[model samples]
Target chain A: MHIVVCIKQVPDSAQIRVHPVTNTIMRQGVPAIVNPYDLYSLEEALRLKDRYGGRVTVLSMGPPQAETALRKAISFGADEAILVTDRAFAGSDTLATSYALASAIRQIEKDIPVDLVFAGKQTIDGDTAQVGPGIAKRLDMRLLTYISKIRELDALHGTITVERRAEGGVQVLKTKLPCLVTVLEGTNEMRFATMNNMFRAARYPLKVWNKESAGIEDLTKIGLKGSPTIVSKVFAPSPKAVKAEIIDTESNQPKDLVVTLLAKLFTKKPDLAHDIAKNAP
Target chain B: MSETTEPRKPARKKVELDPKLARYKGVWVFVEHERGQVHPVSWELMGEGRKLADKLGVELAGVVMGAPGEDTRTFCHQAMHHGADLCYLIADEVLRDYRNEPFTKGMTDLVNTWQPEILLIGATTLGRDLAGSVATTLKTGLTADCTELAIDMENRSLAATRPTFGGSLLCTIVTLNYRPQMATVRPRVMAMPKRDESRTGRIVEHPLGMIETAIITKVLEYIPDNLQGKPQLAFADIIVSGGRGMKKQENFQRIWDLAKVLGAEVGATRPIVQAGWVEADRQVGQSGKTVRPKLYIAAGISGAIQHRVGMEDSDVIIAINSDPNAPIFDFATYGIVGNAMVIVPALTDAFRQHLSTSRMAG
Candidate 1:
């Protein structure tokens, strides 16, 4: 079995902050790391490779610096890494993105047939969760998303069974092989890299593919030209003009504070107090 | 994912939409259901769809796909009560369970039969899973997790506004040249409209010409989540969330105490959940559940944009933090500067007493 995992490099969201004055992202100090969600997908793919004795190839589409993410995947036990980057692919939205990545996957299929494709549920930056399905539709593969567990995989029959998370219950779905699966977060814990794997990752000669090398011949379908949506305006959410009314008391003790706050709350909204009392279970 | 190596070129001019898409009219909301119960978010979208439909002087319709039973027909009636002018119904045995293939085919077939200019769906797991595939198959643009939806009269396109750049900024996206502009809004982000039982509308029936054998994916088993002791923060009227400022897991118990006294749900930030102070299901933020409660009491939360966007829509916000300059204070209706450990226990006791006294009086 040949499994391909798609990953992305995104800024660590915890360190991301907005400038108070200009309302722009403060990206200077934020470090770039593998998308936290993608790690789960990569880990799932590696575990499948371990069980089924298959080769896992990690793929990403980003700038040259994204090679670090691919190498990190290699350290996690991936057999190969490919980075798809190009000057013409700038300003691409999810549609253009899936097109480029799908084209790259087709090129990879020339060497070996890929039985399964894996991707993170969504990226932290876009959080659209559209690329996986877009790629699945473009490739004419069965798309299974928000998969929580891999119940069974019958490679001989070209069939796979998995549990998909739905609104109120879990749906155990069985689909054909050669499909795309978007793994959900918290599905599995990523494994720690071994020293030998780290050394191999450091020396692994990565495959770099551009738009031309990835077999994307349609210029209009690879970048900004293919994106149907446009951002008309980007602005900070306006803060509520009036600040919260601070309750003050003579003594700053917890008892005094509670009394004062309750008095004010009841005075302002008598119905809330009554409702809470009435609905007390 | 590529970066611009050279100077960026000027923005491209808007392209003329295909003439074929001009015939698409009306706005449709996909009414999501599970185990014969319609999700409330579907009704919320129906209310919002009414506004969009009225603005364009077009009809508002609800799309319902389910088994051939009374439940499906009842949902179509309820859809009209919630402001839908009509409903498109598709019934089949294959769609009895929520498999991606049959549901997607049913929805896409409806769109193709009677094209709707704007389609709104709830951003639940099932909705998200279905909308992406349907939109991709139709080769159109879809905006997910949109906080705001408006019709741009200039070009008569849907303007979908959602948080971008990790919730630091809001960007309004428009699918200028795509027909049946699609968007998914999370539950509770939109107000639930009052239902009018007296209202009735037309029901348009469509057939799902799919068979069990033809569909490759099969539903093996379904295990419903155990909701007995779990926190239903998404629909909770009141939520008390803790952040990193709680210091330790023991101190986090104050949140549970307060929630108990007030009959509210307990929520925690991502960091707190990561630190094992609370379960992942109780986390409320961008990465967690989006909640809009009647009252939200945030303790020790610094009001990071990610967490703020999730609960900012609550009717009333009360923030307690040591730092007065915390972003929570910027939007909170009431703010207290102090230790959360101290404030939380006192509030719980006060509510406990207040409720007991009221019960005695009544």
Candidate 2:
């Protein structure tokens, strides 16, 4: 069985801060790391490899620096790593992105048939959750998203069973192989790289594919020219007209502050106190 | 994914749209229904779609796809009450459970038969699953989790606004030349419209030309999420949320105590939830639940844009954080720059005593 997992390198959004005066992202010290959600899918793929004894290949599309993410995946037990990068792929939206990644996967299929594909439910930077489905549609693969668990995998029969997270329930679904599964976050804990594997990751040579090597012949379909959506404006959210009223007291004790807060709060919105009293146990 | 930060090309004289695409008209909101009830986000989109339709001098229509039954019919009427002038109904047994294949086929076929310029859908689990496939199959642009939707009259395009960089900034996106501009808005991002039972509209039934045998994926079973004891954060009247500043997993009990006294729901930031201090359902942020409770008390949360977008619309917000410079203060109704560990307990005690006194007095 051959399982291909798609991953991405994204700036740590948690550390990203907005400039107060400029209203722009302060990207100075924001470190780039593997997209957190992808780690779950990669870990799931590794577990399947451990059980089924199949080769797990990790793929990514980004700048040259993204090779670090691919190497990190190798350290986590993936048998191979591939990175597809080019200037022409810049400014691509989800549509263009899936096109590039799907094209790359198709190229990879030339050497060995891919039985299953795994991707994160969504990327932190994009948050679209469209690329996985887009790739599935383009490749004519069965799309299973928000998968919480793989109940069964019958490689001989080319069938798979999984639990999918829906709006109000979990759907137990069965489908034929050559399917794309977008793993839900918190589904599994990512394994830490062993010291020996870390050494291998440092020296491993990654297969870097340009647009053409990835089988993307149409320039218009891989970059800004191929993107259908255009961003017109970017700005900061306007602050509320009235800034919060700072509550202060002479004692500055928690008890005194609460007492004063309730008094002022009830005075301003008298009905709130009554409502709270009526609702409380 | 399209993070085009480069300055947009200067606006030119109104450019003429493609003749084929120009034929597209009306605004369509996919009416998402489950368990015989339409999701509230569908109504919210209908309300939002109505404004855009009126602005463009077109009609607003709701697209309903589900089992052929009375329940589906009721949803169409509900859509009308919410503001749809008409509804396109595709009722079939194959679409009963939202298997992506049949639903995508039904929606794409409908778009082809009756072209609509703008397509809006709720950004729920089902909606996202369907919208992505439909948009890709149709080769159109789709913007997800849009906070604002409008018509750019200059070019007759749909201007969809959404947050980027993990909610650090907002960007307005436009589908310049796509025949059917597509976008999804998260539940509660838009206000629900007032419903008028007196309102009714025409329902156009269409055939879903697919059979069960043709579908490859099979739903063996569906385990309904047991809601016997779950956090109903989205609909809570009052919410008490904690952040990392609570310091440890044990500190979450203080939040629960305050919530119990006030008969409020418990909420936590993404970090706290990720730390397993609380269940995923209790998370309140851009990626979690979008809540608009009447009273929201946030302790220790720094009010990142990701968390702010989720609850900024609460009727009254009280923020308790150690840092005076925390972003929560900029928009909170009342700010207390102090230790949340101490203040949370004090507030809980104060509210408990005050409510009991009021009960006795009344």
Candidate 3:
């Protein structure tokens, strides 16, 4: 019944600004936060640990500052925290990332058998949604992604029933334990850290691992070298050829504006006019 | 087939396609159909696929997998008119309901057997679900929610451009070593190519070796969503979107009121969508819908690259945030820096006054 939740510390994309000169993200003053989506996964893992009376360990991979993210997870009531920070691990893609995470999990399993692993459905920064499955593939663990609800878990039988989100509807699938689960947002609410747990999180001695400590055997497979996919370049989206045609109404009348806008829009695309008239009350 | 980064273009080296890559042939657009009808996004992908095929000098093919019926065949033919050079049909009774196991098996079978260098799928809820599983099963890389795709003249690499940094920046990804460069494009990002009814393509049919009872997932019931009150922002002619500029959850009511008057659907930024103030489907941002509403009224929304990626395609972008410095004003045609709560209600009343009178006068 022991659980592990993986979280990442990402630049608050909301507040991130690009340097005009460098054309790179300005991170000096940017505040980092645990990915918003990871909260649901962490909370779900904490809930299962609470119900099953087991321990939960939170793990993060980033710069040394990522220790704060691990501490934040502990404050949220995870029993233990681990930080896998290494210079070599930087610039890793989803493929290399899954390798590092899976290696760390295997190391953890050597000490204590992990019954379940939890991760966010996808990272906002990457949005690849590949790490979870990649980790599952490497670790040979069953993957249940975009899970909305955990209907039941039978510890004795090592079986779990969960509802997975498909394209149009929910897929109620039952699978075995020692697997990985990626939780979707709105699945559960995150709880505020109590005064007591906040103190514990502040004091929690984090276990930091580097390339050697993480049990990464192949130097080639743990970072950029291990990554098969590469980001060739980044640039701004090209603007549209023609600028938007503004609907002008000299009358300064709100009704005049809305009507004029519609008239102009439908005049160019007459089928749109039929749709609007049909949907009108 | 050639893998040579020919030093030619200033932007970057040409994608080097190996001469051995000649074995990889045909363009495949994964036809994402469900229920009784195929999703329109499939047709959109087909249109884009035709261009990629034309560049590679290969036949454009559509891979349609669904339950056994005429609908699956009908979709294959429809795909051809949309510019497919061929259709790869895999229909079975078990395929009727969309299941990961059966659908993944069917697709991977066609891919491993036929060897397509490029695979495209619509970035629908179903598309992401199916693409993830198929890519994993095939051990191929998939770039999701691509905003652009191009062929490298040198290496013949399928250069996939997508919004990154939560849509703040755009990054181009290339699957260098992988055979089939798999990608999923969101709906509306690509223009629907002209459909030619006179166009024809070869049809290749394959059998779904499995039966219905063998599939693990059973479609017990489909609770049809009540269509009366759903936001049809994707198909709407005018979308009056709101954001944090509305300030509070309750203030969105004014935006809704204005939208109702203009016969428009309401849209919001990602933060608003994440806040549970609006449905995720109605969210307008990089991670949400790529909208092309005729008239986009962005109330209280400060335009970020993530939010801009979704609504930048609109015919008209009218921004109404309290701060003129808000990025929304930069590209917006009509910028009104005022309280959305106040401005939205005023606009709502104004539209009602204007539209109602115009209806009578006309």
Q: For model 1 chain B, where is the 10-residue window of minimal lDDT?
A: B1-10
Sort the predicted structures by DockQ, highest score first.
2, 1, 3
| Cα lDDT for residue B79, candidate 3 | 90
Tens digits of per-residue lDDT for model 2 on A1-281? 99999999999988899898989888899999999999999999999999998899999999999999999999998999999998999989988998999999999999999999998899888799999999999999999999999999998899999999988889999999999999988899999998988998999989999998999978888788888888888899988899888889998999999998888888888888866765677
Model 3 over residues B79-121: C-alpha lDDT tens digits? 9899988899997877876656688779989998889999999
Model 1 spans with C-alpha error above 4 angstroms: A278-281, B1-16
Against the native complex, each candidate's DockQ, computed on alpha carbons, is 0.56, 0.70, 0.32
Error of 2 at B303 (Å): 1.7
CAPRI quality level assigned to candidate 3 from its DockQ score:
acceptable
What lDDT is reached at residue A55 by model 3?
A: 93
Q: Which pairs of residues have clashing backbones in candidate 2?
A: none
Please, what are the lDDT tens digits per residue for candidate 1 over residues B153-234?
7667888988886778788877777778999998988999999999899999999998889988888899998889977999
Q: At residue B297, what lDDT does model 3 achieve?
A: 87
Q: Taking the true A–B contacts (Cα pairs closer than 8 Å), what share appears in each candidate?
A: 0.61, 0.77, 0.26
**Model 1 TM-score relative to the real fold:** 0.96
